[model samples]
Structures are given as structure tokens and as C-alpha cells.
Target: MPDPERDIASRYREHTGRKRTYILTGFVLLVVTAVLSIAVGSVDIPPQDVVRTLAGYSVSTNWDNIIWNVRLPQVLTAIVAGAGLAVTGMVMQSILRNPLGSPFTLGISNAAAFGAAFSVIILGAGSTSSRVGDAVTINNPYTTTIMAFLFAMLVTAVILAFSRFRGTSPEVMILVGVAMGSLFTAGTMFLQYFADDVQLAAMVFWTFGDTARASWEELGLISAVVAASVIYFTFNRWKYNAIDAGDETAKGLGVNVEKVRLVGMMFASIVTAIIVAFLGVIGFVGLICPHMARRIVGDDHRFLISGSIITGSLLLLSADTAARIMMQPYQLPVAVLTSFLGAPTFIYLILKGRRI
Candidate 1:
């Protein structure tokens, strides 16, 4: 007869090895997608040219400009924003014990939308410029981004404050988040109702999440925050894994369940707030990527976290690339494509009955 202990050890090793392979495959695909995104834009620079341009050798000034000034920044933004949103979503789902938990689940996206509309309509930061043929333009993006960040953080603050008084149970947090989302949606509608044609157009435009809007400066800030968040999450991976077993079980395992949940939620919210403020609410990435990673890697936070990051970056980068080339002169919003991709995949996941 086979030794039972050896059999179990072999099975464990095999499982771990498969997860590692999946993660490595995902990261390789993510890099390929990033390269394709940089190369397959309106002008369609060759992959060789892209590599040369990136490596400080100029193929031509025009290719160099397109690669460096336009496609590179957009691709970088998608990778960073995708990673941040996906990781945050995974953390929220684990900590809150809710399959539906995401950055937007806590009302951050809706609140940021309200703040952006306020700046566009009330503050007159966004206006239609006749010089650009009445195209909507944000005259002061700094004000809009700042306001959006503040309002998103406000929603987080409310949730945190409530958690202080009431216990940090998953049910209570989900209920509060849904209520807050509804409140902010109503406020955004109220602002839209009073706006004129120009302001109304601007507000609507701001809601369409676009990675093209980010510059190197904005990308730097996003990268810094996301890098820091990834570090924190990595350090607390074991605690999250323990908590996933169940609250009481986690406490028995010496995990400070409440503190871990609270701190994890706060960091996730900050990542969400910063991304929404700059990118204007790239939906579905935060929600779907975690589930996709979970389906592949199982509940172990070790593989799941890195899996989510790679999956998120790959999905968003592919969507952004499609958005750019779908319309020659006019690009669609990245969020629109993400919703298209996410909805069907989400329905498929439901049909398959994959658990969180």
C-alpha cells in the first residue's frame, strides 16, 4: 500500500507548483499585452520600433513621439491602475467576506462622480471650448481630481467612523456601503439636473473612465500609492488567509480580525479613491479580476494576490488597446470596453457557480 503521508505531501507539492506556473504564465501574458498595447494604436508602430524607442534608440521622431508621449503613458496607466483596482478588490472580498465587495461597493466611485460634477457644474471648471469645435474640456483638472479624491475619501471616512461605533461585521459594512452608494448617486443626479448643455456634457464625459487622460505625473502618483499598497497587502497576506477561514477561527489562530479588516479596508479604499480620481471610474476591473483570480488560484492569498494583479493588468491593457484601435480618429472610453468584457464573463462565472 502507498504511504498516506507521502501521498498527501506529493499532492500538496503538485498543487503549489501548478499555482506558481499559473502566476508565471499570467505575468508573461501581461507583459505581452502591454507591448501589444504600446504598438497597436492609431499609427501602429512595429513591436521592434517600440522596443527600440523604449530602449533610448529613436526609430524616427514621429514614432518616438507617439510611443513615448501617447501610447507608453496610456499603457503604463492601465497596468498600474489595473493592478491597484484588482488587488484592492481581492482584499475587500477577503476581509469583508462578501463576494460582491469591490472598490465601488463602498460608494467611492459614485461619490467621486458627484464631486467631479460639482466641480464641472458649480465651480465651472469644465466648459465647452469653441476653439476645439465645442468639445468639452476641463479647464482645471487639478480642481476636479482633488475634489473627486476628497469626496471618495469622505465616503471611506463615514464607513470607518461607523465601524468604530458598530462592530466591523461584514453584513453591517455591506449594508452601509449600499446605502452610501445610493445617496451619492442621487446627489450626482441632482447636480446633473441643474446643469446647462455645456456643463452637462462635461459631467457626462467625466464619468466615462479613460486611461488616456493620465499624464506621467498622474501615473507616478498612482504607481507610488499602488506599490505601497501591494507591499502592505503582501506583508498581511497570512492574516487575510486566516480571516478567510472565518472570524472566530481567525481569532483562534491569533489574528486580530477587526484590526486587520479595518486597516485592509482603509488601504483598499485609498487605492480605489486615487484611481477613480485620476482615471474617472474604471468599473468592473475591480470587481471581476478578483473573481477570475480566485477561480484560478483558489483562496490562498499567496497565489491569489499576484494572480489578481496579473489578471487585472492583462484584462485592462487588452481593453484599452481595443478601445484605441476600434475607432481610428475617435477612441472609445476604456470603461465601456471593460463593461462589455466584464458582463458576459460575470454571467458565465455565475453559471459555473464559482464560490468566492
Candidate 2:
């Protein structure tokens, strides 16, 4: 007879150990990295002040304002946006079974950008953004963000419908997104050409992502979305792991393969849309972070997914901090720095994979 007591004890131990490794590790890393982000800024406000300010204690208004208004929001935007992008990439990879699957490759980000551009450019919600450095600041930032998110959902729905006919083949779905992305890019170029100098300038700045403008209100919305995604994805990790094996295998295992893919696709699109809308087009982190996490924790989404979230948040926060400090009195686009780091690392991974 199987030793029931021994089996139960072993299972319990394994469960606790996994929780510690995945959940505890993620929590610790997030806290440490968050502090590092808080400390590294233009005007140094010690960690104590940051905590004190958060605790409803009084501090210098200048220090208070800079910490609360500027660095805090930027740090949060980077973390939330990074985590969202990374998890979305992982989900796309899960369902598509393609290593290159990401918001960029799948055209979700581009689609969201196109929607935002239409609102500002064609419809004139704020100002026509067609050229470089031409930013059409609108009365409501969230209004433009909502438009991007909704449009991205529309695009995802179309992709889902196509995928049903396409038999969920990674190649077919991703190829369609690629063709769609090209079309969107062409449209953006046409708009830029027709735009005058001012609008062109505004368009340029937007294409490159910037985290400097993140505010408390924006942070609240972004955090809520990302936090919910993290939780939802966490519970759904096993389903993702099954899908990774193969859709047929997942279905044989009693998984609702299509439902899972549809839901994952929906959530992933929501994530990409929200991040792209507010943060602009930050590129490559989504692709890089998931690969990095998978390399560290293997293909199991339980650990790999949570690890991706924490690592992405850390990487972006550090990168954004560097962007701020690298050029005194000037802020560079977060996308530029992320691309620099993410692209090289991604290339390294590809080479490493081939060698192995």
C-alpha cells in the first residue's frame, strides 16, 4: 500500500517550499529594488524621509513634493508598466507558443498607438501629433489613455476571431499581427508627412516612451489594472503551463483550451493597451523580461510568471533612474534606455539558446 502519511507530508513540504521560492523571493526583491529606486534620483531624499512622508509625517515641501510628485510616480509607472508588459508578453508566448510573441510583434502596442494618434491627429482630441517633438497636451491624459485601451481590445477581438479560423497556429496569428502592424506603421507615416512642423514634433516625442509625466491619478489606475492582472495570472498559471505543452495536450488534460486562450488573450491585450496608452511605446522589455525569468525559473508559469513581474519592475526602475541621472537637468526617453539594455540581452539569449 502507498504510504499516505509520507505522501501527504512530502506534498505539503513541496508546496510550502515553492511558495517561499516564488512568492517570498518576489516580495523581497520588489522591496529592495523599490528602495534602490527611491534613493537614486536628482535630489537625494533619504529613505527615512520617504517612509516618513508616506506615513503622514511632515517633511520639507520641496523634498516632499519632489519625492511624492516626481520620483514616486515615475518609479511606480515604471514598475507597473514593466510588470504589465512582462506578464503580457509571457501570456502571449504561452498561447502563441512563439518565442518572439510580444505586444510589439503582435501589433497590440502599435494598434494602441494608432488609436491614440487618431484621437490626437485625425479627431483632434488634444492636438494633431504628426511630427517630431510636437506634443499635443490635452486637458485629460486619462481620456486619451482610455481610447488606446479600448481600441487595443477591439484589435485583440479581431485577432481572436481570426485565430479561431486559423486554428490557433502561432505562425498564422503572429503573421497576421505583423501584417497589421505594417499597415498601422504606414498609416502613421502618412499622417506624419501631412502634418505641419508642430504636429510632427509632438508625434516624435510620443513614439519614444516617457515616464516623467506619471501622476498619482495615472498611477492609481495603472496599479489597479496591473495588480489585478498579476493576481489573475497567478491563479491561472497552471492553465498556462498546460497550454505551453500543446493545445491538444491541454484539452486532453481537461483544460478548456480555447476558453483559456481567449481569456489570456483578452487580459494580455488589456495590459498592453493600458501600458502603451499612458507610458507611450516602451519597447523590448516585454520580450526580454519574460525570457530572462523563464531562463531563471524554467517554463512553469507559477514561478516564471511572478519572477517576470518582479524582475521587470526592477529592471525598468533601475533603467529609468539611470536615464534621469545620466543627463543632469535633462530627461531622456525611457524607451531609448530600455531598448539599449533589452535588445542586447535578448540577442545574447538567442545566441545562448543556439549554443545550448
| Winning candidate number (lDDT) | 1
Output the worst ten-in-a-row residue range by lDDT, candidate 1.
128-137
- In candidate 1, which residue pairs clash? none
Which tens-of-lDDT digit does each residue in 143-228 have in candidate 2?
66776777777778778888888766677778878877877777778877776665565556566787776678877887888888
What TM-score would each prediction reach against the true structure?
Answer: 0.96, 0.87
Candidate 2 positional error at 229, Å: 2.3
| Alpha carbon RMSD to native, model 2 | 4.1
The best candidate by TM-score is 1
lDDT of 1 at 356: 43
Report the error of model 2 at residue 19, Å: 7.9
